[model samples]
Target: MNKQNKHLPNFTQAISQLIALPSISSSQASWDQSNQAVINLLSAWFETLGFTITIQAVPGVKGKYNMLAKLGSGHGGLLLAGHSDTVPFDENRWLSDPLQINHKDDKLFGLGTCDMKGFFAFILQACQQLDIALLKKPLYVLATADEETTMAGARFFADSDMIKPDVAVIGEPTNLVPVIMHKGHMSHKISIKGQAGHSSKPANGINAIEIMHQVISELFKLREKLNLSYQNEAFDVQTPTMNLGAIHGGDNANRICGHCELDIDMRSLPGMKDQELVSWLSKALQPIAEKYPARLTITELDPSSPSFQQTPESELVLTAEKFSGHSCCAVNYATEAPFIQQLGCQTIVMGPGSIDQAHQPNEYLADSEIIKTEQLLAQLIQHYCF
Candidate 1:
């Protein structure tokens, strides 16, 4: 190890400390927790290694935080980014404490072990192996909050227009592979309101459920249209998809259905915009709304992330492919890659651990991956920072 690395925490030590801090970000209020502690701990660790630390609270998000640690100074540097928060875990489903790292059979089990706190350990280990005095360009480590739910930290960072690196690597679990393209995510709630009255006289009140049927039909038409219109063979699905996840309406059979609500989720392709899709959907239902008037409403569930596609020929993608010895591929899942790419940098998601294990009970990262990831990160740092 380089002399500079001697002062940093050991690989497992860092991972242990990170996992012990439960920074679960969830849409449910009971499960959501602040990520400030995680950010503070990372800030301290990075500061000890001669990095300049800047901690910023994600605007509009009450307690979340984002940390930027810069090691060297110059243009066209490399940004190693990861989210500090994990999905809420079910304690009863885990074999042990989800917040504590449990080592058995050469695997470390914890909430964020594979799904990503371990990636930060890899970053620290890689930085430790580097001799900072020889750095030719800057090296940045970003820790953001709320990746599991809203990606609020990444959105705030991208909008701030700070830290413009030449290339960015988002360490989302991919088993050491480079993900060059991924889908976008958007969800909406469609609500229909109508008068409630006895079922004896059907004309006494409007049947919201009947109106909902029309809305559902229009949605199906829109979904089919989207599937026929857009196609990206690189992804597994190869086409956009809309899922009608849930629907609720009348409470009793005795009365006309007073109100109805339908929840839907859509996965869009690379070139598709979230608002455009929403607009298309709204327009598709315009006829029903026109016929019913003042009863149909479409509401966005949350902020949507756009699909991301980094050119396979980008220098970062080529370098990662060459170093990791794996061809660049596409994932069907959405990530913070699009937000980071907004900084005018070539960005790709590459990291340690399998995404399959993420958010699962008893999540673990094989001990073997520890050294392999560290070595790969070292090679990347050498090529980009030095």
Candidate 2:
């Protein structure tokens, strides 16, 4: 709606191009088969825009590629980072085809249109309009894989000797606002093993299910303790919390269960160390270990995505706030910003879609939000790179 962005062409074609490719990262088989299709398309688009592109393959996932493209020749430029992967969607739950971009009124609906693919489209559009002759620093665009599942691509980028920018922007649907801080989620599965016997005789069997209940009770108490310990005024909840996401054990009613497993989710504040949280959980479960010879095994499904907090006065924060015509705020959902910040670059999460639309059926990005994102990105390019 801004006057500055009026001349730019509609981004619907680009969004359609992206939504046609199903890049669901959670399904390994589907991701492996279709990831290259999206990568090849993006690589060609970037190459046409005069960017030198490289497709980096992550280990363990064949055909999944992380594409890095750079424009201009100088260093310390801005990096527009987004994930090419999306969360898996059930086809039966959608009223319309999830893979096709459908426009209804002012919103464009599709599978990845809101969760991320729309943001990638805007980045591509911005790249096509950039003038290398007027740029002061090189611009880097990184499209990573597997952000919905393990964030393996970001972890790989963190360890590699790739392009290190002075500041990084994670294009994760923030509704055009800058998100500086959020909670980190750490998931662990605890497995317990015990003796199995006939249910008729109570003393003869060590019930794994009963032992798991004891462990879960202790975890609940630990959650309350955490609620009392870490509190922040900036966040709405003001404290870290824990949840028992899942519990599984026992075959049938006839026998004592030999194995039981519990899945625990811990959300931490910005200052809490992940290892420290694990250590605290270990200590809490220590008392029950000797009761039933219960074996305690903890395996983290996804490593803690640490919380993000940057000083309000930082250049990146200030620049983003000014360009977007909004103030900085904290979000409850985590982004790839914290991981990117570990690379010694200031990071901010900002983009077109709203968090309300993410991970929901018939998810969409508003046309107005897309236009606003384009204008803000144009201002950012002029101020930082030009």
> How many clashes show up per model?
0, 0
Global lDDT scores for all candidate models: 0.91, 0.81
TM-score of each: 0.97, 0.94
| Alpha carbon RMSD to native, model 2 | 3.0
Candidate 1 per-residue lDDT over residues 116-196, each given as its tens digit: 899998887777777778999999999998999999999999999888999999999898899999999998899999889
lDDT of 2 by residue, 1-386 (tens): 12213333347877898899988876455444447778887788778777899988987666677888888877788888888878878778887899999899888999889789888788766765666678788888888888887777787777786777888889898888888888887889998987788999978988889988899899989989998888988888888878888889989898998899998888888889888899999889888876545376778877577777887789999999988888988887777777788778888998888888888899898878877887888787767778
Query: How well does candidate 1 score on lDDT at residue 61?
Result: 74
Q: lDDT score, residue 45, model 1?
A: 82
